[model samples]
Target: MALRTRAVLVHRRTELDELLDRHATRGQAEFFLRTRGRTLADVEARHEAATSARSAVAASVPSDWALAEVERTDLDRFLFAPEDVVLVVGQDGLVANVAKYLDRQLVVGVDPEPGTNLGVLVRHDVGDVAEIIGSLAAPRAGAGEGPFSAVRCDELTMVSARLDDGQELRAVNELFLGHPSHQSARYVLGADGGAERQSSSGLIVSTGTGATGWCASIAHDRGGRRLPGPTDRALAWFVREAWPSPVTGVTMTEGVLGRGGELVVTAQSDRLVVFGDGMEADRLEVSWGQEVRVGVAERRLRLL
Candidate 1:
């Protein structure tokens, strides 16, 4: 049997209609309408381009497209088939809205960021994402069994050390430790079995994903001279050798603690900030010897 194909056009109403006129067949294509910003002129401009393109294509093929604005509740109905292709226009925001309602279906994000929309959408919708291109394969099936599974949080320990129980954790491109007070904060950087006492305005750890974010731009001014850790040294070399790094996302899995004793985290004179995935959480303070733990999570984000 031939593969059954369904096309979903997500664009401005005018543009959607034009695309339908050119690429859609009576029984094959459907339109889902979405508008951007507040201005109608932007919508009209997109419509004109779409209509013009459709007019050009219509001369050679029979267009049998059906068009309509996609309703939020009906999104599941449209995505019911695994073979369905969703063609989205506008920015990542629009695509994000559509993805919330879709699951377990093949989604082809058309004209997405760079050459692939798959990675962009996946980063926003799920966590601990690494993009795979070209070939399609079923994701390995297991619970917390992948390369990053060891450090992933399987269960939150109730015993309070530095991090609190029920504190959710996730890894993004970077790990952010910020303060609102505009005064430098003290931190102790450490890895497995290794530790260092350092003072800074704030600290950040950047992953490959967040090599270009704020974590990369902020200067580490404290003169605690020691050979950089593998990742830190590499990032330093990158800054010296390559383009300025960009911030991606912050670490959300670990806990922030106060400096002196075993306190989850308390507000001192200076406000403590911990931000990840472009979102901010409660602010607190850290004293001289506070510890922070950051690591990957156990669960993988599955894309349909």
Candidate 2:
């Protein structure tokens, strides 16, 4: 018999659940919201919508497939198989949060609250997920252009940061290297061409997938040109608030990275950190003399 497909539904807590968790009771939660001139009814309604969306997704999973539901916080502990199909049922950020943890597993991003979420990553609606999942399972004739093709999984670029100590982290959106507290960080920034010792707020290394986000803002602030697209197979780097002192020059502030291209940073501070996809809790730490290399990851996000 063939191995059954496994679907892992990823989700996060709703606001109402958080309120109840904090207050310890529905009555107390409602009262607390009331005191702030906000009604519990609104939160309740939002929770109901989310619940409905979750139910729709659960009901749509193929009966023959193995199913599991994972809370966003517990993803670190969840043991995913190589064949698992990941489903993210939250905002676009949730998609980014989970993508780094996966190794080429097909991700179906479902927008739980379509009415409110911009959902650039979580673009599919709950109603359409079953069909999308089915399509991904079915073999195709070409690059999802045939009449039999019901879905197309766009391969998004990703970045990886490998430390000299062999520690590594991947990012679907971008990677941040600097002080965890966003303070002045000193480092020797370098590439294949040359290296420079500099002091700055931090550095943001982004994939084409992250061009419209933090990278876009940085590009705009510096009067730089627009960044690469989501599938551009290149990475962009920007130094945030690079302090131009007599010692720290600002010439090496921004650039693009591709295959055989990488940005190396040698830590000049007592403590520096490398984190991917805005997840600070999951990070790699480097000491005063350590170094990290950031470049495009070998793996890509197969978005269904």
RMSD of each: 14.4, 3.1
Q: Write the per-residue lDDT of candidate 1 for residues 48-165, one digit (tens) a residue.
A: 6544433332221213322233533354355433433344443433443454333323333333223333344332211111121111222323324322122222121111112333
Which residue pairs in candidate 2 have backbone atoms (N, alpha carbon, C) closer than 3 angstroms, thus clashing? none
Question: Which ranges in model 2 have alpha carbons more than 4 Å from their true place?
Answer: 137-151
Model 1, position 86: C-alpha lDDT score: 45
In model 2, what lDDT does residue 60 have?
A: 82
Candidate 1 residue 222 C-alpha distance from true site, Å: 14
Q: What's the lDDT for all of these models?
A: 0.34, 0.86
Best by TM-score: 2
Candidate 2, residues 43-122, lDDT tens digits: the string is 99989988889888988888878899998888888887766788888889999999988876778888887756745688
Provide the lDDT at 298 for model 1: 28
Model 2 lDDT, full chain set:
0.86
**Number of clashes in every candidate structure?**
16, 0
